[model samples]
Target: MEKTDVEILFEQIDNITETVQQYSNETYLDSLAVTLEVIFYQHPPEGMDEKLQEQLQNFIPQLDVSKYKTTEIRKALQLAMLKGMKGATQQQHLMTPETVALFVGYLAGKVTAGKKNLRMFDPASGTGNLVMAVLDQLETAGSVFASEVDPTLINLAVLNANLQKKEIEYFHQDSLRPFLLDPVDLVISDLPVGYYPDDIRANDFELKADEGHSYSHHLFIEQSMKYTTPGGYLIFVIPEFLFDSDQSDKLHAYLQENAHIVGVLQLPETAFKSEKNRKSILILQKKGPNTTAFNQPLLVQVPSFKETKAMDDILAQMNAWFAENMNS
Candidate 1:
């Protein structure tokens, strides 16, 4: 049988990344970045050894990146990135699961339905996977933005976005810091869970703890809200214990004052490595004139992905709820 586009592209990416890694002695991810550059530019960058350049030249013609759909391209790249991430030791380096990203995309599409030329931002765009997934689901020709603190991750994200022909303005700085950006119509992020190390900078945030390091996830929500236009929406994949932590009261107060909790959909336990890592999809609308809380917040317990029938039933219920409430 003929290979699917995603399979073909993943094989090409994997082969190129492996070849680059062998030649340059770079990590799998960094080598994949070089591979992406070569694929995108159709040539190895200047200063690479002649043998490696020749090898890359031989590989380029075999690639059929342009013919594939956006989702296929994303899937291919995501598979390659996931392979690289296997050897990574840092918790922050973890990629969002494709299934979760797709679900987020679906919810985003539903909320922003009928909107045109909307602006969106993702402050924790690791390798651009989640944001690109969201972009694929959107039916708008709007501005997109992302930020990341890690240089290697940001470089990969840039190359990933470029290869996919996504026009995203990226901030290669700490996402918690102030950005030279206008408030956006929507914000989405798979929030980085942990305590933020910078207490002094944490002082600038309303969600900052009164003492010691602040929970970075809390600060992320506040920062996302800050850059979301009044009446705009923010969607996040949040830790299940977000509202049960020692600092939950502060976060709760902040949200109550500034945004309305539109929904909280608990992701299936099977999706996570452990109960400690379980997360939920949280939707919030920034408080503004003419905006009111939903009559009944959307609260769902998502079924496991492996259970197709259960998943479909839950999605139908979600669709029905959205149709009833969001259309008004």
Candidate 2:
């Protein structure tokens, strides 16, 4: 069978990374600049919000599009970007894996049925892949909002959004800070993983009251939970250590007191095959002040990619679990 558009796009994107890497004199920065130029022309800034268009207009340089077709340009844009965001510059900068991306869509699709025009947020949206995943899974349209701690990575996020012709206004700052932002329906992110230094401002959150303690993934979880609407769902890709780690005892208590741990999915080992870190996706639905945990959360394992029956089986279990527990 002929290659699908997605397959072709992936191949072309790989070509962009290889080609850019091979350029003896070209910096990845220069290659990145070229990629951004291509993205803007391929997905014109017209019809975008005036402020967004104005912000985008300031940066989109005219490029030599005569060399490659529009499809190739978009792929090249993706390729260069994938290469640019290499590793954990911070937890916010970790590259989301393709398998996890697929699972994110699956997880979202399971619960979002019959809902239309939702609003979503990813606090530490590394290149906004989770944001992309949620939008892709939704049957109807929705708005995406995300914040990235890294300025450079946020540029990549903007470029990717332009390529997809999606509107996303990214806040470039620390997500841990208690900024007065609107509570969104769906809150999601692959939050920063390891310990945070005292100067990072994560300790500023009221939950991190212990001046002697160093904040880490636990802080991200707490802050994101607060950011989500009381009835909204907060999804995170967190370390397996979070399940019973001494470090997160306070976090666990807070979670027990305030939120409903909706779904715990053991991600496949390949979810972060590069770094080989054991991680899981934690789906929590925030609760109102007087609310008590009414439903027992579901804990399921992600099936292997080769397991033909895995995804369907996993989702089926979740569907039954949600039917019993979602609003109970």
Candidate 3:
């Protein structure tokens, strides 16, 4: 059987990435960055060992960038990155599942429908996979922005966007820090869960804990809200225990004052390895003059993606709900 586009592209990426990893003695993640950089520039950088440079020069011409579609390229890169991530020890290093990214893209497209030349931002855009996935489904994406504090992730992200010919402005700083950006039309993130270690920075946020370190997920919501345009939508993959934590009361009150709860879709438990790791999608629309709280917020229990009939039925109901509730 002939290889599919994604499979072919993944093989190409894996081959070149492995070549660089083995030659340069770098981690798989770092070597993937070098692989993408060389691919994007169409040449190996200067100051490399002569043999490694010669090897990369040979590989460059063989990669026909124009032959692959953007989605195929993105998927291929995602596969290679996932391989790199297997050795990652930190929780923050994990990428959002492709299934969840696709679901978020669908929701983003639905919520922002009819809007043109939309500006989008992802505050915790690790390696740019989720943002790229969302942009693939958007009809009127205007300017895209993403922030990441980790140097290695940011480098991979820039190369990832460049190889796919995506134009994005990136901030290589802690996302919670202030950005010189104008408010954006939409915000999305797989919010990093755990306590934020910066007590001084924590003091600057309304959701900061009363005594100890602030919950990073809660602080992310506030920070995302601050940068989103009024009436703009924000979607997050949040821990199931978000509202049950000790800081829940403050978070609830803050949301009441600033945004409307649009929906909560409990992701299928089968998506995660354990119940404690399970998460839900929380959708919000920042409070504005033109927006009002929905009388019936969209509450859904998402069916497993493999259950085609059940998934189709749920999506149909969701479409009806959006048409009726969002038309106003």
lDDT of 1 by residue, 132-211 (tens): 99898898839999999999899999999998899999999999999999999999999999999999999999888988
Which ten residues in a row are the worst by lDDT in model 1?
Answer: 64-73
Instruction: Report every candidate's CA lDDT.
Output: 0.92, 0.66, 0.92
Candidate 3 per-residue lDDT over residues 1-328, each given as its tens digit: 9988898888988988898888889999999998888888888988888988988889888898778899999999999998999989888788988888999999999899999999999999989999999999998999999999999999999999998899999999998889999999999999999999999999999999999899999999999999999999999999999999999999999999999999999999888768998989999999999998899999999998889999999999999999999886
Runs in model 1 lying further than 4 Å from the true structure: none
Q: What tens digits encode model 2's per-residue C-alpha lDDT throughout 1-328? A: 9975555555544444344445424555444544454445644334534554443344334333445543444444554556655633434545667567667776666555556787778888866666775666576547778888776677777777776666777888777776557877777777677666665475466456465555567788777777777767778888777767656667877888778877788887765654447788888878876445654677888877667687778777777877776543
Ranking by TM-score, best first? 3, 1, 2
The alpha-carbon deviation from the true structure for residue 108 of candidate 2, after best TM-score superposition, in angstroms, is: 2.2
Misplaced by over 4 Å in model 3 are none
Q: Can you give the TM-score per candidate against the true fold?
A: 0.97, 0.78, 0.97
Candidate 2 local Cα displacement, residue 39, angstroms: 3.7
Lowest-lDDT window of 10 residues in candidate 3?
269-278
Which residue pairs collide, candidate 3? none
lDDT order of candidates, best first? 3, 1, 2
